[model samples]
Target: QLLDIARKYPDFPIVLETVRECLQDVYDVPALTELMRRVAQRRLRVVEVETATPSPFAASLLFGYVGAFMYEGDSPLAERRAAALALDTVLLSELLGRVELRELLDPAVIASTSAQLQHLTEERAARDAEAVADLLRMLGPLTEAEIAARATTDAIGGWLEGLRAAKRALPVTYAGQTWWAAVEDIGLLRDGVGAPVPVGVPAAFTESVDDPLGDLIGRYARTHGPFTTTEMAARFGLGLRVTADVLGRMAVDGRLVRGEFIDDLPGDQWCDAEVLRILRRRSLAALRAQVEPVSTAAYGRFLSSWQHVGSSDSTGIDGLAAVIGQLAGVLIPASALESLVLGQRVRDYQPSMLDELLASGEVMWSGAGQIGGSDGWVALHLAETAPLTLPAPAEIEFTDTHRAIMETLGHGGAYFFRQLTEQASESELKTALWELIWAGWITGDTFAPVRAMLSGPRRSGAPAHRQRQRPPRLSRYSVARPHSRAADPMVSGRWSALPAAEPDSTVRAHFQAELLLNRHGVLTKGAAAAEGVPGGFATLYKVLSAFEDAGRCQRGYFVESLGGAQFAAASTVDRLRSYLDGVDPQRPEYHAVVLAATDPANPYGAALAWPDRAGDADTHRPGRKAGALVALVDGRLVWFLERGGKTLLSFTSDAETQRAAAAALADLVSAGRLPSLLVERINGVAVLDPGVDAERAAVQEALTGAGFARTPRGLRLR
Candidate 1:
């Protein structure tokens, strides 16, 4: 009967029992929010009433199913879905009633609900955009179905239609389905197909709306005027072929003008003819203004601002002091400071001023990075650097590189490595300083501390002019004394210290062997053979014999009956001792065997009887094969001979990982991790080719033949 009544008249009041029953299924926040939003849109109305059977009446108007009024004359309920969604309204409505209608309809509540809807909408949009971008990069061109499959939202059809309407992506009819592609890829596809180039702007809209092409061109010229057809296509989200054709027509019609070709821009540009004419007029006026002379008072002001020295001053002695005074305690780029002091009238201004100031102990310069710059310079006032007392007379022999460094730093300013790089070749500077550093005259922490000029406190009695005349100087070194000879234990080879401590070849082999054994108790023949250095397998065999002599380790060929539990139960120390016996000190593997046996866990601790590895110990030479390929994996250098015959996979050219590979290599190269020699040895670098198919056997064969190999992470060259 209730169904019949509801069917007969829409908006009929749904009884509290029926309303609660329907709502009982929806307990989630998302579902309730969606329900409330629908109600707010008037898809349904929430209502309440006073009734005895149900007590406090809570009912809803089922607009789609029934009428608000009944044939039996039931009272109509007020619309209040928003209030119910946010909070229980029965108590508030009864307590306040119409007295607080304004509070009930507060803007804050309305905005809060709207904002949630907006946030969900934006998140969906961003996800869809990312999915579309990924699909285009991986597949080159994709049909609507492919995009929908990857999209995050269910309304893919509507979202795609919206994107099309907004001209954010292009669509083409291919193989009977609409194929979508990124705007930039459209140009590549047309070129790849070898389409005949249009002779001129193919008659723009002769059969369509009035001068739509002309209007678009005019608008583009007005905003991004003097832009090429490629740039226009990208900005407007149109195909380059069509955009170029239309632009050509506008040029023929004298409605558009072409601009000079720029190497960086990669093409000729177009502008509305009127815009071109306006630009030409402006350029001509600017030229005229350049030739015009300023009044004497204006000239005087410029000279005063620059504190210009006389032309016959010859040397920068006068100019240097004046420039320092103008700059005061501030640190500024050498170029900017030079330009300000010398104006356009001087050439070779920076080097000239540097010589004068540094010789006079009036200024300092700093490089970028931890140390400071090779090309760029940061100037510091000598007044800001603390005075240093003279040391006992000692020979101070200086190389050209050393002199250049002093001139760069001047009296005592911080500089970056690149700034130092500007004074001399990075390698030369490193080489020249190697001796001084090794001798302990200089330390690894060579870069000066970065200090900025801070404003001084206001004084009650001192004159402002006097304070300005005597600014405080910051000291580069807190204490000027060099460490005493007794302080350094390794003073014999001072001035030629090696770069860093490297493990002995024997010790390193022992460490790697131990790690392998711990991870896998029994090393297979192939695993032992695959060690990076040649003859490592024989060294392991010798070490096993010595362990046997010491009764700390065991060594023998694997037997079928030796189960996994047997290996696990055998103590590593007992095995090592049994394995290290009968090793000769004169043999090549003696050091390796001895090193492995001396592990604290093993009882052969007395095997070495050597001092702890020193910081400047003689370097160990590993028997690595020549021409070995070195590649960085997870920021550590790993040598790879071949790809183990696995098929190579290629990712999209624009994939984040692929793009970041070059940057990673550059970073490693800069950090001195990858030597310059190894960078040159990279025989066949992999090029990112997104359009190529990886599954093709012929493609794989060709890549392999050319020394290229692919891994899941990226492509590599052997």
Candidate 2:
């Protein structure tokens, strides 16, 4: 009955509006039908839960609304909002194309949408001369025929005459057409003359008599990118010159920005201020997404070659410094750093070159990890950024002797051992010096501390047989003076401590992440953890992700099995792609490069885990320790020599590969990587395990052929 009343009395606003409010806006019939269909077909389920009291949503439905958003509905702020909403209704009563850009780049779709919106704007505009004048004010510049057609009347010519005589409108020649615009907009429309004309729009007139196009046009501009006056006019079904004028007014009012927006389009264009920011952000995102993923094997081999392992591509002291920068914050033994790590990278990495960098203060070393016995492992850092890169100091036990040495050095000058001994005995001072060094407080002017730190019972690369060959000194056992021994190579360099760094954690984290990328072309949580990076990959992850957002680097699944959580500098990704594995299989030729088991480039036990021992009962497994060695044959781990350099573990069962692995160990000794290697066991068994042709005979034979002497206990390299 109410529906019948509403239909009969169309003039009664309450009845029809109530029906629309309930069925059209409040309760959507189509959605309700879809929900019912889903329930009926069992595609969705419905359940009822009885609560102790009415639920929040149920109470809302029962009371309709609890209160207004503000304290009162009649407040001044509320009154202003209500006024704005009322004005918005008239402005949006006939909206143009949707703000969402569906056909932003497609010309055909844009054109069709343009025509439909133009026709809609014309057809919906009010039908009168004052309304035409307002259109000129809002979206104007129309010929007489255009105004007449838009107004759907033949009397538009008469309206033009009235407007012209009243001096309310002016004419302008634009796009080879004389179009009339409101007199006030001449500054933005271009120079004008005496003229009057009009055309008609479609027949869907709006109820409003006082239409303001400023707010309407401003809202429309936010939906798309840069557009010219002609393009916007055609799309909106308004006068081109008038559209440009309105756009210009908005630009002057700081609501819009004018420029040559679209690169290919030839003309000045205007875009919404916020819209330009959106466009720039989207462009950066598109560019950052252009990286390609590569396989783990390829990335591993690429890293090996990139760090100059097994390759002699570096030269001079500058090259040595670059390698040190790459190795910053990486903790490795001082001994292996020169013999194995740096030597593996630079072509002719002489000790003299490193001494030069240390002497020049271009590179600095600070003890980091508590890896090697009492002295610990050290991390190399660039002299400039060393303060920023230094990790938080760890607590250490300082003795009186240590305090005396530090006090003497704290006087601000480097001191040799003999000088510091004036305050303490030589033995006491030497022990105290290393304690301070391991505490990360002191360093030597030369590399002597590194040598002294290695001077423990765990001998360096000095051949055991050569030690016995040294003839006994015939000189008297008299008190030695500090004469020519001033430049002693052992431990006589001047010792001084670096001021403790009080770093900003955030700044330090960002810097560490950048250096991490510089060290490893591709960074992964496992690899970062392997290096024992402070706070682990979790801390660096935030900075790296930020780098990606800023387009400084890329984040992607660059290596298989390393997880999708990976980040790399842009150049790193380029180099990784330039040598994809399958693209040219034989290019990075297979050479057995031996790396300290703890070297970051070893990849095994870092990016990749160690293979299971050959026998389940085997007690020892491969680990990344200071004194151990790993040999990679084309980025595949085939040998793991334990830190003691006695027990050898083989990852492969191939006889020839076994020989290759042992031969590589021999080559390591030949390259001065080790004084000698004594292999007593292979894969948890004796090298010649019991039988004439032992189970691990191949390794024994290979070691012997590589100049290893057969000692009573094992195969020893001389």
Estimate the TM-score of every prediction: 0.18, 0.54
Highest TM-score model number:
2
TM-score of 2: 0.54
lDDT, model 2: 0.66
Off by over 4 Å in 1: 1-207, 222-224, 261-266, 305-718
Which sections of candidate 2 miss by over 4 Å? Answer: 1-293, 369-375, 418-422, 452-490, 582-589, 691-698, 701-709
**Range of the 10 consecutive residues with the lowest summed lDDT in candidate 1:** 590-599
lDDT of 1 by residue, 159-189 (tens): 6666566555567543334567655444444
- Model 2 worst lDDT window (10 residues): 198-207
Per-candidate Cα lDDT values, in order, are 0.37, 0.66
Give the C-alpha miss distance for residue 556 in model 1, angstroms: 99
Candidate 2 at residue 197, lDDT? Answer: 27
